[model samples]
Target chain A: MSAFNTNNFSTNGYELPASVGASLKPEHFASILHTPPPLGFFEIHAENYLVAGGPFHHYLTQIRQNYPLSIHGVGLSLGGQNPPNLQHLTALKSLIDRYQPAVFSEHLAWSNHGNHFLNDLLPLAYNQQSLNRICAHIEQVQQFLGRQILLENPSTYVEFTQSTFTEAEFISALVERTGCGLLLDLNNLYVSCRNHNWEIQPYIRALPLAAVREIHLAGFHREIDPMGEALFIDSHDAQVDDAVWALYKSIIQQLGPIPTLIEWDNNLPPFSDLLAEVQLAQTILDAYNTLPAKAQP
Target chain B: MTFDAAWAHSLLNPDAELPADLRVWNHSDPAIRFAVYRNNVVASLIQALADSFPVINALVGDEFFNAMTAIYVRQHPPRSPVLAYYGADFADFLQDFPPAASVPYLADIGRLEYAVIQAFHAADMPSLTTQQVQGLLINTEKLAQLQLSLHPSLQTLQSSFAIGSLWFAHQGAGNIADVQPEIPEALWILRFQLAVEVLPMSAGDCQFLQALLKGQPLGAAAESVIEAEFDLIRCLNVLLQKELITHFHYL
Candidate 1:
């Protein structure tokens, strides 16, 4: 019943990122903003700026004037059984109203359980019950915010046994039912595929291309088993791997270029490293734009 | 419960029996993904707590912090998404923790740390001027009944142990044992301009502020402090200079 029509938006090739720089501290954020690369938009974890009239808010306002913004939320626990927190929704709505970010997104998994807040993205069962629940939660959020939200697929160490629907199927169903867009994190696809011993190509191919409005590329850590089976960690602390970049190329080649963000959260390097990754992403995005007519979307 | 709500219940408690109409019950791999979520939810909360209460974590060590956080997470999950304010109840959790009981001061330390964090994020506002204070004293006799408003982010705490010393030490100052803990300490945490700062207050100063905070006018609050060896003039100057007292109301 909301007026957030996703498929009919002006596609006229919205500005695609060549690459984007990322930072956690406000001083570093200000410094990065002043010397922004071609893809100038900066993304921030929404939880960091939830405060009112503080230094963080002050710096964000200063930065907002110069660059396009994206609010990537780590909370909201959309897949949990509990209804979305009305207070949290109100807070997010307040942020959206203030920033008017180019994109607003949260993960498919739940972070809070019952009355407890876990502060991490938990996995959800991909079943009809979950599908309906997530759809309803998404509907409530969209209706309340009065705008469409892009839901990102979560990185996982395990898959739910009760999931009747495949990851792609669950995503497509969500787009169909709630009209929410997808934020495909190519690194997450690679991470999930490598962990679950699945083929990444089919998983990427199965995504609802038209619904994907944003792309996320981040680094992952690897944990090896006694048998040398590698478990990829979705730790956003390092550089984007070559395999993930390859997947990004593959995704852009088919789905067309999307607004991309390069996330680096832990063991954060100096601004140059993040800017370099953003540049790397932009280079790939540009390559897709100039791909031979046969390869272009 | 509806299928969606039932699924939610199961996600929070893995031991909960699956609802009959739950969509995941018909899935080929429901438990696998369920386990992934279970791991994520628990791990994420544990990390948030660790991040917020670094001193508590450092005092207990990483292994201990992780285990204690797991128990704390299960017992006290955050009710709001504003994680900066999420661990407000953690101090209480430590007081009741059986393992933490050995370190009786742990709870009070958590309280002090929580207060500092609260003060750090409190709103920004200008304070009352000295001229305004002088004007306010025109009705000096009614000062006892006058209530003084404190900053939104200001937090005043009193503890029996050397919790204040322990906290300051953990903040790269010095060791807590180095500061003798024979006497109880009253502490004030406030944002003076841009940074949040913590300092110990004398018993008289503490009593004075607490009384004023409780709606007592300056006359009555100063009397309480005078009995406790506080220099009324000096305290008033400090309060005014620090911009702690925002407004005064005479009852």
Candidate 2:
């Protein structure tokens, strides 16, 4: 009954050129504007630019003019117990309209509960209740935005005892039900797999990879869990780990060059350093570009 | 409590029991694993406060600031997920925080820092052109009845302590030792072009601007400034030069 034809929504039409990009940081705004770097596109956290108007918008407006953008939302809390915040959703719609980004994405995890926004992506129980809640929320968001959004898999620390579906199965159902796409974050995959002792390849194979329109690569902090097993924290501070890069290479080899992004949020290095990481991902993407097209999953 | 409510409660309250439903792969104690989320929630909110109030953090040092913000984070977790405007109540928190009572000027600094952030993110609008301002200024009768609209970013703060000098001291523009914190100061903050500019304001100018901000007409605003040293020409000139006057219309 609504004006939007939600059934036709697909991320395939919104794919960025098969190349690499970096998270747009305020520190690197000047350099990015000084000379538009040789990157495919820049990804920005939607919450960072949710303000009315300022340097964030000022610089992003100019940068957006030159580069294809991916607006990544961190605050939607799609998996929360309640439905998505209508006010936040309205703000997101305005931002989407203003920017008209190539791809819009959000995490699968919930960051808010009740009146408090936890400020970190928290894990959710992948049971029927949560799945129903998340699917309904995503459907609302998609209908409100009138476009398909890619839900990035979260890097979580713990799992819930009540979980019925595996994380991959939960995500696959989300895509199937909401007609949403996946923003496959390799760093998160590595971190979650390492923390939970889940094998990486099986998890990847379980995901609805054909819905993946974008990929993210970031660094993680290594710590020890209470069980004395190695724990990886999804800290976006350091350079992308070599192991994550290996995972990314394999994913790209199979998927054949997705829009990969280098996300370095905290303790940001110079623009050159980020570009160096972008170059690394770009190297992998470029290598796959030359290969014969693989069969779509 | 529902699992979500219990988990949310435990995240902000350090001493609260962890949600009963949390689990790890090895069946090991989930306390440490769950602490990661608790730590992340508190530490990230604390970091947001520290980022917004760096001068306050520097004045209080890391250990004190972190500890104080931890309590504040628990007391007032952000209602919204946009961390950019998360610390709106931080200044008020510092005012009543017992540990920070030693630094009496700390709350004022928090206010200034918060104001700077507000000004930095306020809606962008073009300032009235010089010609347009002059065109209005020449009509004396019209000017008296005109209600001027300042830039959305313009903010004024009146502090009993020398917040402007203290802020400048932290910016390396002035010697910290030279700052006399006892002196009362009125500060004007606005984003001129891209940079947020902070300047010391005279008492009379502060009153006049505050009145103007409240939608008082030019003549009424000028009359409200009871300070003997209030120079109408000087304040008008500054407003014109700084492009703070965004628009004006006859009352």
Candidate 3:
């Protein structure tokens, strides 16, 4: 076992209150540093900062001092056939210790198999066998980090014929068994429901909504399947779609304010554009914040 | 084969049959939906390579680069999930790629680009100041036996082609037409604070620096390149200016 005792490490009391944030992009480092925006927190892909040290660490160190951070791991392969990688866990623990992020999350998808890491979030069969494997992985990760991790729902293109449990059932089971939280990605919920023809509201209601600790909203690309049915790609390139925003508003109204992040990864626009999206989310959050306590969830 | 092994195999190999027990709600051809994952896996890896080797992408047009990296991606999928260090073997791959034979310098450029990325992400260490260096130089006898530690971000690449000029050309600092590819060049790459700087160096200075990086004492490294016109003061000046030397101790 590693020598890191999570009890001894202090997270500096940084808390990500219910508000809006944005993905911390390298391009916007200058703007973020010069004029810090009124954001609840900032989220970063854990793999990007896995290196020993560099500007990624340098800037993140400075930026983290002012903002509550959320480290999202895209490479843990939580749903893979094998257990999580030990070295990756060690690195992740060190990063958490260094930055003391308020929250850490990963996907319910698998990206590694054998010796190859496919870089894309691949779908998994939601069966008893797979569920057991994922539960063990999540338990190991939580034990190693000494904190619960939020598993984000994946935006997958295909479904497995072998899956016995619905996506919501599988996620709910994982949350119940492992004592983990849910990172409700509204864009993913919208995209997966459209792709798989699953009912959106029912799917959201089916999930253990009370366990949702954070939310993600991003834009996706549109495509057509062979049957001429619409398919949405979670591309994270454009502005959040109107439909997704409506879904987010509905969720916020029901669940009250949650830590929301505007994720724009590729074809990045100026910092102001991301701030605009942040402002959009903040408006909805602020609206909910001002609501009477009795009216809130 | 197990489902994971089968699925992984099919993702990298287009011809491999899609893993059994895959479907969509429509039950239409799953191949079309499966193609999305295939495309994502291959295209994202190719994009990672393109991100790391932009000069290589520019040298060979996007069409050629994409096609070439497609082949490389299938042959060498990333072993680690860190996409930044995905193309460590790309330079060697380009060396033997028959289609890229016309551009012999492409492989060298790939190596240079990779080094730049490595330096960009290397560990941060406090560099020695000029005053500290001057203080060391004052003790001539002690300096000869002193072993200097270079900054964690310093990288030295010696190439037969004008790699430094070619890289700069792509960055809009110079014209590509003015680059004499056949002219030999040695490159010094290091990150000062936040920005990564790539500069050309003489062969003699490069050898001396390389020797110093290999833990050679200051006097011996300087002596090894003396016949190559290695100017100790000029080399020290550049090192001090760039804050490359991080620590020094007498052997």
Candidate 4:
């Protein structure tokens, strides 16, 4: 598959078709591809397309041929207490072999414990034990797939008091141990920073920039408690907020342009709206390309 | 706690004490952030359970289903991030789930749905053709030691309630009362093309497939069916059409 190029799309930018502002169903996905965005790629959750021979799998396979696809996995609890699931690993490996995604990624969070499976990307303890477990899991996964996998940072709600290391340090350790690249979800960083009351700049800067390969920007809904405490939910139900877009711009400025994807899963707008989001990212990337090196720092 | 271990430790258990960074959230800013994560964690999980077991959700209604999922979510929290494989133990949970007892058939429905999902994701393999089976079965007496291969997408579930009828009724077919109880159904669930099909099995067919699944030789499998009801030809025909019995290999 060709590497995604932002300049490939129609010069005239995209707009949401009047008919589909509320939702984009399976039927709508086919037409949406024809009105392609400048950024010639799409990222889909791997689990959503795991079926024997259904429409989900059918559409994914059809669209995958045309687009520079990336499979973002939400499951594969890489930081779990137990070893990486061989069956799950085998299944994932099969998918990678089949699709040949430009980037294959899973979260740093643990979702399963043993027999029980937590559907959410639950946080993992950042002590030596957890770090060791995550590294081991990543190594096992990389070995099984015979390829490097990108690990995305999750949007966490709460932090444990027992944690002995910073999130960036933990991720850096994993990269060092497993040689896996990073899929920096800027929106997650912003949400996590606000939730943890940490400075976002230091956290972003602390990342092992050389290992960073891809970027994700998703929309979030705001939630508050009775105490008036704020949480930016990574709901992916709306358009990329201005704050998130700003973060994306900063990451691009620092890291140079990367393969960026706009994730709008639930509460989806029309095909044109998705293309517009891609156009916005492309515009930012184009601006970075023209900037002088000395002028940027 | 150091910054590195902060988020990792928080994810292990929901009630784990918050780290300094996480706990230091300002009332105005952090609450929304925390609520966002918390709500997504709960809602997405609940939604996954609802998706996998649509019948359970439909039977219980939205309010009760949401409530049941909340309690289930807290008690048997997901250990994996994959929601498709999340609710494996939900059937067992329903047995002790107090509110769900009113809908006694809920657990069986969950089991059937789980089986269907398992069949759908099972490894890909080709079924034995009629000609291939015939070539092997030419030596009928030798069939006693022949091990039969089954389709990867084949699943069999035996339920006392009219689960097949009940499951069918909920498929936007018609009213629940219109479903006749008939006899208990040992469903032969198979995924052909894109659809997961649940076909009601006769007593003999169920026994024969159950025997074959146990790795019994063809002779034993057939004997088990003949003992239940001597309809060997009819059972073989059904198995052939469903493409369940893949091959009869000599052991």
Q: Pick the candidate with the highest lDDT.
A: 3
Whole-model Cα lDDT per candidate?
Answer: 0.74, 0.88, 0.89, 0.71
Write one digit per residue (lDDT tens) for candidate 3, span B67-121. Answer: 9999999999998888888899999999999999999999999999999999999
How well does candidate 2 score on lDDT at residue A259?
88
Question: How far is each candidate from the true structure, as Cα RMSD in Å?
Answer: 4.5, 2.3, 3.0, 7.4
Residue-level lDDT tens digits of model 2 in B62-159: 99999999999998989998888998989998999988898999999999999999999999988898789778978977777889999888888989
- List model 4 lDDT by residue over B61-166, tens digit each: 9999998888788677765445556788999898789877777667888898888777766655567876887776698778688898787777778776677888
- Give the true-structure RMSD of model 1: 4.5
Isolated chain A: TM-score per model? 0.91, 0.94, 0.95, 0.87
Q: Chain B TM-score per candidate, please.
A: 0.82, 0.97, 0.96, 0.83
Off by over 4 Å in 1: A1-39, A224-230, A289-296, B1-39, B98-102, B129-147, B175-177, B224-227, B248-251
Tens-digit lDDT track of model 3 for A1-297: 222222232334665779898999888887889999888899999999998778899999999988989999999999988899998899899999888888899999998888889898989999998999999999899889988788999998888878999999999988888878899999999999999999998999899898898999999999988788878999999999999999999999998889999999999988888899999999999999899889986
Per-model TM-score, in order, reads: 0.84, 0.97, 0.96, 0.76
Candidate 4 structure quality by residue, lDDT tens digits, A87-121? 77787777777777766789998766455554667
**Runs of candidate 2 exceeding 4 Å displacement:** A1-6, A10-14, A292-297
DockQ of each: 0.30, 0.83, 0.82, 0.26
Give lDDT: candidate 3, residue B72: 100
